[model samples]
Target chain A: MAGQSQQINISDLDVPQLADVRKQLEEELTHLTNSFSQLKQAQAKFRSCIDSVKEVAPQNQGKTILVPLTNSLYVPGKLSDLENVIVDIGTGYYVKKTRAEAVKHYEGKIDYIRTNLETLQETIQKKQDNMSVVASILQSKLQAQASDKANKD
Target chain B: MSLEARLQAASSEYARLQAELSAAVESRQRLDAQLSENELVKKEFAVLTPNNTVYKLIGPVLVRQDPADARATVDKRLEFIRSEIKRVEAQLTDYDARTEKKKDEVCLFCFPPLSRRAHPPLHRQLVQIQAQIQAQGQHTAAATAATA
Candidate 1:
């Protein structure tokens, strides 16, 4: 009968559920932190790329270098900071990236970064909101308990 | 004896204001459409090239221009975008200011924000005011659109 019947364990589920929420919020915080790491890496990549472009095409290099977006998504504030990190690999790399075969290779990495960023941002916002809600709930409950004690006294 | 004449004059003035509102709205719609088209063009340009790219796509872009001509075209387009943005912003500001003014003229008889006097037929007056508000909203939207 134990094998056939589904078990519905209800003991301390609500308290345990709160712990579960905390764990999820922590995970989300970690992911949000990852965005900073990616930004740093992107900055490094851009610096090296710009250096090489400056060597070959010094005059044109002084002007803005095209940072071709493989994935079309905008995360305004985060991406705006990313503007400083574009490294123009060189004319050869540019020509190769323009070539269909070479472009597809980088597309894989670009798509991953874009998707990761989107999820990370959303998780960060949601977790912060959840924490605020939980805090308010707790504050209200505490006030109610204190009021009950006062009434008895 | 000419009480009817006074009523006719008020109705005529009201009709004139309504017509002006509609014309303004139509003009705004046209402008809005133009702005939308321009925005689309800008997006397409950004995509075909790259963000923060120095050179924008010139339609059927003629290459190797005289330095002077190339510089002038670039300067002009940039100026155009700057001016267009400012113009739209100003129009929005004007609309906002006008709306705020209209709101301040709320019925003095009714307390709090929307005081429409406690007349016998409160419902009818409220309905008329509500309709006027909606029509004003449309008129504002149309005016802004015309500017676009």
Candidate 2:
């Protein structure tokens, strides 16, 4: 499918066909937009993880802290090991890494998300462009039809 | 069977196929997501030393795991997801083809093949028939006036 490229002239399509094309493009654009926002949220979560990892500094070692086991419940605990933190890589797997390694892991995730976001943005831009072109073509076809009716009358 | 019944059956089948296709696509997306996540974990494991501690979260408890074992588990997961994706993709293509065939059947039932070849679409033919009737009525009215 990727090897084949078909160029369609939108102006040649009748109003109903053009409408169908526009509807398809609109659906695709909405899906892409939803994905973009989801990716952004994921990136934000990763950034927060980096910040939380940074908070576990050497200076804060042995400091008393309130750990929330639940959203509304907090348990008082002492920071035992500041150097080693467990990082959840994904898919229910966690790895023990040093503070630096954890930060690097999050940064890597953030970078991956960033690249994906860039490509998604490009795709969204292209779809929006196609949508506008289709819209304009549809408008012109409707105008032409109306003028034809006026001429007949 | 009656044409109306056939058209109804075709349309209903098309709708069912469409629903199934969407479900398949949704699962495919989920599998793709899981695959990418496992791949990321595998990449992370690649850089880790043999001494690094790996833990698998079973329920709420974290169980210590050998790095080699964890990597093997991730590899197996990746393989499973890949196979599942392939299966879903095949099902999607099958659904796509079926839906298209059903759509064509519905269209055929809506405008029979014979009439489609001889005239315009059903709606356009209805308009033409209405115009001809009106024209005939006007002609008869004019003839009656002349005879009177």
Candidate 3:
């Protein structure tokens, strides 16, 4: 049957006719894009590729929770023990000033407080000295009175 | 219906919130500006306010009463009070000078001149002079009426 079909073709075709036939064959070989299954198949293939990536890569991770140690004194959002962090620092912000400038202001304040404390301490010391002197004087007076009494006896 | 519709709704909500935030920011800015203006005005008014020495002289300057027992309790409360009084007097003088210095700035606020305090020295002299003048005028008027 193959030999009979091959022998039936005559070699009488011209160049223009052969060219037209070749063009018609090419047009006929082109695929129709209106097929729904082709689109679905392409989509499935894309999804399979995504699934393969998911399997090879990582899975959906959950949120992380940070737990403090048992002896940890500080909680995440809790302030200081008896005061807030800012107030606990024992500093005040100056009016329309920077930290360094405010520190300079505090330097004067610290000096003033130190001076007052020293003066108070000194005055207290002086009072204590006066008290000791009076105590000695009173003790001597009592001794003198006792001696006088003994002499009279 | 779809993710795009949901996203569009979210975007619209976000935009509305953003607009509200912008309006709030503008209002805050306006309030801040108004507050600053008010402070400046107050400072200017205070500066322009005329200071009188009267307030200083109005108070008595009697000595603090001595403690009943200076030897007892070992406290320096009376001394501290006297010291505090002196410090306050000095501060009052300093503040009065400051007020006088700020008088020009206070003029922008446009207030009446502060009345003078009842200065003992000036008041005493005024009383004496007024009495003498009244007596002289009365004597002269009596003499004139007798002649007529």
Pick out the ten consecutive residues of candidate 3 chain A with the lowest summed lDDT: A84-93
- Looking at model 2 chain B, report the run of 10 residues with the lowest lDDT sum: B139-148
Q: What's the ranking of the predictions by TM-score, best on top?
A: 2, 1, 3
The sequence of per-residue lDDT tens digits that candidate 1 reaches over residues B1-148 is: 3433433344344445545555545555555545554443333233333332322334544223233443454355556656665665566556556544544433321234333454435545545654565455544443333232
Q: Model 3 TM-score?
A: 0.23
**lDDT tens string, model 1, A1-153?**
211265634232344344444444555456557655775586556455444433343244344444535476433222223212222222111111232322333343355456656766776686688667655555565677689899999
Please give the RMSD of candidate 3 to the true structure: 54.5
Q: CAPRI band of model 2?
A: acceptable
* Per-residue accuracy of model 2 over B29-114 as CA lDDT, tens digit each: 67877888899899999999765699999999999998888889889988899999889889978987886677666666554444
Candidate-wise lDDT, in order:
0.45, 0.77, 0.36
The predicted structure with the larger lDDT, 1 or 3, is 1
- True interface contacts reproduced, per candidate: 0.00, 0.67, 0.00
Better candidate number, 1 or 2, judged by DockQ: 2
Q: Which stretches of candidate 2 lie over 4 Å from their true place?
A: A1-7, B113-148
**Candidate 1 positional error at B90, Å:** 1.6
Clashes of 1: 10
Q: Rank the candidates by lDDT, best first.
A: 2, 1, 3
Model 1, position B39: C-alpha lDDT score: 48
